[model samples]
Target: MSFKALIVDKDDEGKTSAGVQTIDESRLPEGDVTVAVEYSTVNYKDGLCLGSGGGLVKTYPHVPGIDFAGTVEASDDPRYTPGDKVVLTGWRVGEIWWGGYAQKARVKADWLVPLPDGLTTRDAMAVGTAGFTAMLAVMALEDHGLKPGDGPVLVTGAAGGVGSVATAILAHLGHEVAAVTGRPETADYLTGLGASRIVAREEINETVKRPLEAETWAGCVDAVGGAMLARVLGQMKYGASVAAVGLAGGAGLPATVVPFLLRGVNLLGIDSVMRPHDDRLRAWGRIARDLPMDKLADMIQPATLADLPELGRAILKGGVRGRVVVDVNA
Candidate 1:
């Protein structure tokens, strides 16, 4: 069967090019289940894989979508059968294996999760990998003893996909949310997502030469790392923890150990790719119950396969303001 896909291929001069292409089902990689992709999503990783950045994709002519949701078209594995609604995120499928920026996908049955109730395939993709990661971060923060009564939780890069969802979820959990963003225009957007306060990016992106700073945040869900992480670490409340989820700012951690040693602050590293199955299920279940779907619909921006190239570049530039749910069939 012929299908349309967003295929990225680089040239000999290291110039990268990407666009939609027509390919055959026979070209799909070996897997136990095949899905007719209704929706995929754009994340920072997908942006990188679609372009020449991210350092995640090591191959050429790749399909760069880290999250997808649809119905199984066929399955050789007993775990799934044709017409089962399913979703996938992480497990490095979009990076190392062929992924879901297309009309169809064949992936290991182990990577598939039956779509949680109260979520359509489009809704699932709207949450996508970024939203899933945000959920994981929220869970990690709570597991670290954070509560809504624990003072204001900070969400860095609040306008971005992961940060936006984190802000909404934290606020939904009854936490006072402080959304940090460079763009002043997103204040209303963040507030609509339940943020009680909006913090300017310049306030927190300072060089962390100080081992400690005046404590401002009770806890943090950080999507921007590098100096932001270092700066936020110093500003966290004593005995507070930060869930470090992304490196949109930068990867280098120019941090001191004073927060850990003196303040008892915790920096929890979060990885969504290799998450254990049970944890994934629990997170999805919680998301279905806790995430405000009405608010989520307000934040979703739809795209098609043809929009991937521009969307990829926009995400890298930090221009994307909300979750982008790509309709592969569109």
Candidate 2:
């Protein structure tokens, strides 16, 4: 009846600290289901929650993992029963509620999705929220008429989680992938993930005087956002769609309307959190069927609950590459 979890707490002076602690079962949050968590993952939001709350975590003694995969231990919801495999992402669970940085988690059944058939719990965590958002982006692009033969698909922030998965999935689907990264050292790694070309971060990260450049990318999965996204808009082929997934570069978009007005370009905003159940199922199914497992494996860097505090900080600094799968029980 007890579980181990990484708890982040703030002191009277406003300093925040995080560490693994044993928690009683009675302390679990109100929910229809209780899960024996197998794996969880660190995300940029997790970093904020682990630290000063970043305006995302509104309370102390918080659990910061944004996504988790596990098996149901108990359930009041008819859709799930004990022993059912499940996954949780978004819904601000880690920020506004207790989350899966624990050996056990209690959550609303509505926020849980059955793990796709081909992906193990570990694989689910490896993909995490970042990869899930990436899949949504790709689906959005496809829905807007993007095709493999049209031209190369650009994946900005290619060495990071969303970009890495997007590059791999796009490449496996026969699209030529152009990966953009600030770190030149990751070029070989990106190539191994099926990127046909590596575009330096400098090549496309700045704002341009001309709002419409020579139309280049047929589609884009942009995780960098900010100026990079603004610049990418100008480079999109006529009527091409760019899926905006993150603001790692920044949140402000200093952009002009020329790309949208003159070229009929579409900017699609992707939000994995608060996604509908049907969309979650569709994305997970596509991930299992289209994303190459070996590539996902290569993107994984394993960690334990004890490793979260440091990993959380690292992710915020953009020092982490690929995905970090955290084994909560380890």
Candidate 3:
């Protein structure tokens, strides 16, 4: 059988090009299972893979989707069968391997994790990789002894997927939430998601001349790095931790490490890719239970495969808000 797929390729001159085209099952790579994919999503990474400067896809003719949820159609592994539901987030699937921007995908048995009990395939894709990373950030804070009573938790890039979900999850858990964003229009959106305070982007991006500021936040989930990360480091409460996730701002940390040394602050780096299978499952399980579904309705905006190219540009420019759930078969 044949199906519609999005494939990017490079020609003889090494020029990159992408399009939606028809492909046969024979084009699929080696795997233990073949899935009838129902949903995938657009992440910052997906935007990178689709964009001209996005470094995610080094090889041509690639299908760039980092997150997917579906049912198995064929399997060589005994643990899986045609009826089981599964989801994929990392293992560098979309970057190093062919991913879920197609009707069907064949992947290693080891790369698959059973969908969490409370989430449907659609719901799973709604959370996607970004939400999973947010959950890990929240879990990291929890693991480091952060609690609601300790102090307010700040979520930078609060309008983005990871930040929005992180804010909601922390607020749902009864913690005070301070959401920071550059767009003033998104203040209500962030407030609606349970943020108790709305902070300006400029307040978090200014140059840090001092080693430490007033003990501002107890913990933080920062998706925007660069100057934003550097500023947040100084604002944290004594011995508090910050989970550094995305690099939407920039890759460089241009500030001193005086906050870390002076206050006993910890900077927890979150890398969802190459994470142990057990940890991924646990994170997904927590997301299914903790993240508010009704709130996700506002955070989630659905798109088709055809919308990916435009979204890729929007996300890179920091224009996108919340999760972009791609209905792959739509």
**Winning candidate number (TM-score):** 2
- Residue 196's lDDT in candidate 1: 98
Model 2 lDDT per residue over 252-328, tens place: 99999999999999999999999999999999999999999999878999999999989989998999999999999
What 10-residue stretch in candidate 2 is worst by lDDT?
57-66
Q: Give TM per candidate.
A: 0.97, 0.99, 0.97
Decide which is better by TM-score, 1 or 2: 2
Model 3, span 267-317: residue lDDT tens: 999999988998998998898899998898988888888888888878877
**TM-score, prediction 1:** 0.97
Candidate 1's residue-wise lDDT over 188-281, tens digit each?
Answer: 9999999999999998897756889898888999998999899999989999999999887888999989999999999999999989888889
Worst 10 residues of 1 by lDDT: 53-62
Best by lDDT: 2
RMSD of each: 1.3, 0.7, 1.2
Which segments of model 2 are wrong by more than 4 Å?
none
Model 2: lDDT of residue 184: 95
Provide the overall lDDT of each model, using Cα atoms, as 2-decimal numbers.
0.90, 0.94, 0.89
